[model samples]
Target chain A: MSDSTKVRYLEGHKGPTVEIPTPEGVPLRFTVASGGDRAGAFLLDAFLIIMAVIVCGIVITALMVIDSATASSLAFVLIFGFRNFYFSGLEILWRGRTVGKRMIGLQVIDRSGKPLRVEAIFARNLTREIEVFLPLTILLAGDELIPNLPPWGRLISLLWVMGFIFFPLFNKQRLRVGDLVAGTMVVQAPRRTLLPDLVEEPAEEVASGEMARFAFTREQLDSYGIYELQVLEKILREPKTPAETLLAVSERIAKKIGYTGEMYPSLEFLSEFYRAQRAYLEGRMLMGDKRADKSVAPQAGKPRALQTKLSGKERSRAKPSASAEPLQWRTPEDPPQAASQAGDPAGPRVPPVPVVPPAPPTPPADEV
Target chain B: MSEIALKSTQFRQEREKRWRELERLVTQVEKRGIRSLTADELHDLPVLYRGVISSLSVARSISLDRNVLEYLEGLAVRSYFVVYSPRRRPGEVVIEYLTHSFPQAVRDLKVWVALSMAVTVVGFLAAYGMTLSNLDNYDLFVSPDYSAGRNPSSTREELRAVLMNEGEKVESQSLGVFATFLFTHNAQIGLLCYALGAVPLLLVGLLLIQNGLILGAFAALHEQKGLSVELWSWLLPHGVTELLAVMLCGGAGFAVGMAAIFPGRRTRLESMVVAGRRAGVIAIGCVGMFFIAALIEGFFRQLVNDLTIRYSVALITGLFWIYYFGWVGRKARPA
Candidate 1:
């Protein structure tokens, strides 16, 4: 499992990449944020903090007029401490987001694909003291403090400041000194849409019995998992993907999953394979078991909205409760739910109908 | 067997509903924060998340389609980040960090701290030896521009006067200004030491040596002129904190650099990250040390000319720090 992770990086891909695995062992997909976006977030955060500093400065100045001696030092500590404190505080509380990160649609996450942790946040922001804030402080503030300072001090401070500011540009991930240390990455929040399935309808394009061109045994269907299924799906939907590549992928997958049938066109095989896999997965789901988990008896108690509404609408729950579908009986034609009910001598556990017969030869797609 | 498979359209018909729902909820959470979701939507999120995960699981089990799998994977992750991550406040975070994270990190880098001390000590010893071996070696380490007033040529009485801030008019204002200057100078070196750790090949060791050399050369001059008593009093008032701060910063740098040079079992990046966290914390925390050191050097050092008083103050501060850092929050019950 870990071996594939090491070689996950491919050529031409920029930005920081993280691989998260589901229980099924396939990696989750996410797009890491670009540097410009992060910079924008940083600018927003910097702006907010600067406003705070200004407010603090005003308060300090007022205190100075009232009681000048300690106020100045108090002001310095406030400014110094707040700059370091702000991001770490916000990111940790906000779950790897500051006001700027939230506003800019950026989030920090563990590079290992775990939820963001506090140590990472602390490590990263602490580095910001030297990397982003302190250098600027030294270069600008130090210049004013000691007027007769030697030339070397000023030059060194300036160089140090520039190096930190530009460090992100040199790396694809745009990690600062802090991020590099924490093994955390600032990424855009995940927002990928499921593209419309392009597999042709039986009545629309596929010829009579063409869907059945590549038939497989139940054992063969059970042999492969969702990760493999997605690969096939990607090949079929991606028209731009080459024919040879599709053939190569499907052929290799067929061999690996123990599909013992006469070869059909790659698209037909994929369509058939997709359909069978879908049925099996849906059946399993009805039993209330996850992909890899042991099957449990389906609950007799239907949850709110699922029984009455279209599973899709209930799935999204997009409409407010006021307008949502209130009650609707299960349709006999509902392939998956109907199948779950078919062989339920006891619990409405899914896929049992298909599994009971083991090799109920040539069960129709609708009746499986 | 052939009849068992559904048409491509029917295959999607069975599952697209759940996939689409998850996609929308994920989108909503992404656009607005997760808390923006309605109660039902909130309840539906994990349910749908589990469903989608199951779908991916089944999809893989049957060797299902990629687009569907990709969509579910994306949706699962989106919801995971939102629903799973616990909200926290900045105050809580700061408290946790100060009470545990910062100190734990500091303690972890004790070896690096020692290494940094070694560099400073070696530098001090080498410079002291060179200057004491021959008066000419004084020119090798100490520059006239930086020496303020004391030098190898200065007589014993002059060195003693200068070491105790007795040479000039000893006005408080100039001394304060000079102390502030020294504080900034030390801090700049500290920052440099830590930053240069990014590339272990250069700067980390050199800067510490440079620091130690200057200290050694100055101390050697005073010692040779029979002004060690004056030198000890002058340094003790604030130098204890000031030097510790400098050495701590150097240690932080060495910690970061050592990660790069010797990553141990972890990858280079991983090791650097582990080291960078503790070292960077030490470096940032050391800033306060500098500020405190400056406060004492600027105000208190010049006012009190009594050597015993200065030494006692230094002793109390040193002991206080040892207690505070070593045991202050170790067994605390606060969150």
Candidate 2:
């Protein structure tokens, strides 16, 4: 059977990502960039190489007192070899961010979003002589290059240039000839996102009871990564976000987190869940306790009481409330840190099955 | 503010400052290299990294904004490489390639090397025999310009002078530069042959065979002129190394071409990709061979005129290369 990813690709997403799950259960997504970006970077790199070549040529002819004709020929070799070395060298040394790639906000990474290795760098740059540099060089300077070249030779060169240069446009990922050869990709480098300011929370210290409604076990919080958290935040911020969409997203998250309790308002559950999870995660970070990555979960029915008491890692399975306003969670009544602190990642964290009895409902709060 | 936006905005206001601070520090680390960081800055690196990672995870699961996600992703990746990946100096890389990667690649591509030899040998013998069999086909393969008056019609005396006069027609400094240009040009041709494999490989065959035909025709023409011995002696200083380099590239071309023609359960593109990787390595490793060949041809050939000494040099160099690919870097081979 065809891989589902290819099927989705054929169905047509302009650029699809290869998802590599990190230790945190967040898939570091690498999205393939457009061919135009590759060309842009190449042109920039080529310009730099050519300038260096000119300097070398002048040095050889003037300082070294070499004949101009010989210097030009020597310069040509330097120009060619240096182009290959520059890219392969810089990328491997810097783990795939070249000067041009850095400038264009593009990077070369393994399909799995792993850092690049020297082998791939060599593969791509070596093949580039034919796929990119050769064809481009011929197309641009054919007339003067081999003055008496045969018509067939010229035709082959032209066809060669066109074939490799345009190959990326035809592919779904806009991958160039070298990219195909090396099994590498060019992607837009991710940047820091500036989020809109959130409304200030109540001045009261985080209330243990309010946090109880959104209290998530470390595993529950670990289900989604920072990427997912921002995604949830974006949805929460949308003015016209539909109810069905919210329901669907929250339900999926709830299932993943193993929450099997009564369904609360999806928005309320998510926002309250977001606040609690954020607090829990940040607290762990502050304490230098490693967030339990998805791979290492509390084994079935296994909870360490001593370590849980010491680290105060959140071990509570989710307690989804039946409220409409998750805002009640932001009250600063000294956020129920003690309860979460009492819970450890290795404490009670069975989402599909609750380890503790249901708690009494909190008193209703005034609507914001 | 809407509850979620308020929550998100508050979250951002509380943590964005630290995230930006960490971003600046990380950017500084990246730009100036890790060594440039102060001791205090270095101590704070991981703490800040953890902060960003936590922030990224929280923002990702809660925030709906793609801008924040993108920012976190970029920072996370940069920091990930920074914390985990080893930094390599350019000199280290060059040394690594020369000592380990190149030899290992050459060994791995032994199949292509053998195939290239086969094609070249077949072409050499055929062209060598063709001139012996019939003089009429002489012009078909060997162009007169390249012949440098060493064709069948040339006298033995004229052919013998080619040994001394060949390649020296140019001045010394220009000769080295000219040779370097030829090496680059030939390297381009070798890679071109490999890339042409994507065109269903018809040209790949033509290229390999053309190289063979030229060698064979040249050998045959020299034999006809009764100057074959002198030609062999003259070519020995560089021909063995040059021929091996070209042959390896020819094998690379064939490997790429055959992968396209017969995909062996993979999609044609996938097969080509695999072959392209191998071919890429072969092409890269042998690039220096062209330079070595140019040096031998330009300086050594002119210096070492005696046939026996030239032959010994060829044999020693040939054995050295064989030993290199066979034994060197075997311990450090990548899994």
Candidate 3:
């Protein structure tokens, strides 16, 4: 399992993630927010600021009819307040989420995974004046402000501004100068719902009289482990899985397990295999023998002894309804078991008397 | 086979109600803030949060369905922020900053403040000496637009009159407008100084020196006209507060610049984080100082014509700031 767990990261994975260890010692992984999302949120906030300034201007103009001097003075103060406080105020109030961030489902979190502090909020937002507004103002009013500047100077200024603007692109975590300075990162805050259990779905198939068509002896079931079971479970749960893919996976598993059964439809073979594999692995798990993957063998003595004891108990409990259950153990007369044991190159373990037979395969149509 | 499945199913069923309840409360708080919650819900929030956290831990250990794990993780993250985020009221925060954080930050950055002060003084002395040696040099240091007719060409009486406020009527309404403009302008410069501090130290130094040069050239123009005493009275009344505010901003900038440049043993980003936080407190405080200075510059200097009163006001302000930043919040440390 350790090897398989490590392989998960090395293989195909989605976007960058930040792992923040909780107080309970469990590390929680959050997806780093995309640059496009951050930019969209910033634009939304900028639009809101512009609208606010325009509204304030309209109000000031109306007040001018009453007292022009006071109204104009109020206008200056209001604009100044808005310019400085708009980002910091909202971020502080909302605890690292501005109105734009909330709308976009993004949040500014401390990079080191601490709780976002008020100082950090202020520091990050204040940098926007330099990183964004200062350069923008300079660009718009550059010729008027510094008339003697040569063409190269203007280009240099433009480059300087672009460096700040595209800073996030240069970093793996997509951190802007403000985020870097404040030790914060923006992350996606996705809302997800719990899915129905995959195990329960197989149980429903049994209720509909679609009993399993293919089954494996205990030795055949031990070829794979929990990690592969989970991978198979993921494929089975995905609605868009293609029939050819299922057939290929089923054929591959049948070859690996050395099954000499009549071929069944791919989905039926896979589901039956998944259910039995899960039950077998879980039963071993209950006996304190967890097989992460097929690379490691099950522990030698204690777990095997516990498993035999558990199977004995299960056989006694399942005797009355054994025929309908489809998971019943067969005697040594089972032809497939004899054939599998003889063909197996690796010497077989002590053959217990009770063994399961190949039950009829359930069709995949009932699942959909 | 069914026993293990039944156990997990039963475990979820028993706790699912609390988890749903927590989700509802957390959603409500996120949308409308914690204030929107009823007392009972507020009390239940922390309790439910703990329940969800524990459930998440248990689910992780048991290797529950992947979707269930993801859902629990997301819920826990959201609830953690809601529970742990700082909830100090705005009024409390303002009071705390004004009384403690602002002064502490200023004291902490005193070395950078001294360095900024030295640069400004050096610029002032250089400009003053050059302008005094040759009156024509005043124009080089002070722009004509900024001088507002009190240049090297103006007569001694004209320059003195400019400083004395002999017969000018103080218009309260216009003064209010002037104060607002001055406040906005000075606050912007202070913020710029703070912002530039994060980039390079040289820019902040240049800005501070430019301001000092302007002041020095004007002083030399008055000194050349033998109206030095009158100029001092006129300038110092508000200059003490206003210049200090500007210098504080410069100092804050220098602190940030130093953190970025040197960073000591810490990583540059980590160093900047500490400096940026402290500098923010100083930057905010400077705005308040600028406002007070603007009020004095707009109203008091123009209204009060007595040099005695002006000099006394300047002296009082200098002392007040000395006490405010030095001794105001030293004794009651958070420890």
Per-residue alpha-carbon lDDT of candidate 1 for residues B81-166, written as tens digits (9 for 90 to 100): 65555545558866776676566666777787778788889999999988887877877787676786667777887776755667
lDDT of 3 by residue, A3-61 (tens): 33323322122347778976545566788888888889999999998998999899999
lDDT of each: 0.64, 0.64, 0.75
Give the higher-DockQ candidate: 2 or 3. Answer: 3
Clashing pairs in 3: A1-A292, A212-A360, A213-A359, A213-A360, A213-A361, A329-A355, A330-A355
Global CA lDDT computed for model 3: 0.75
Error of 1 at A203 (Å): 18
* CA displacement after TM-score superposition, residue B82 of candidate 1 (Å): 6.0
lDDT of 2: 0.64
Candidate 2 per-residue lDDT, tens place, A14-74, comes to: 2555566554344565667767777888788878888887788778778456467666676
Model 1, span A52-83: residue lDDT tens: 98998889889878866557656655665576
Interface RMSD for each of the candidates: 12.0, 13.3, 13.0
What DockQ do you compute for every candidate structure?
Answer: 0.16, 0.22, 0.27
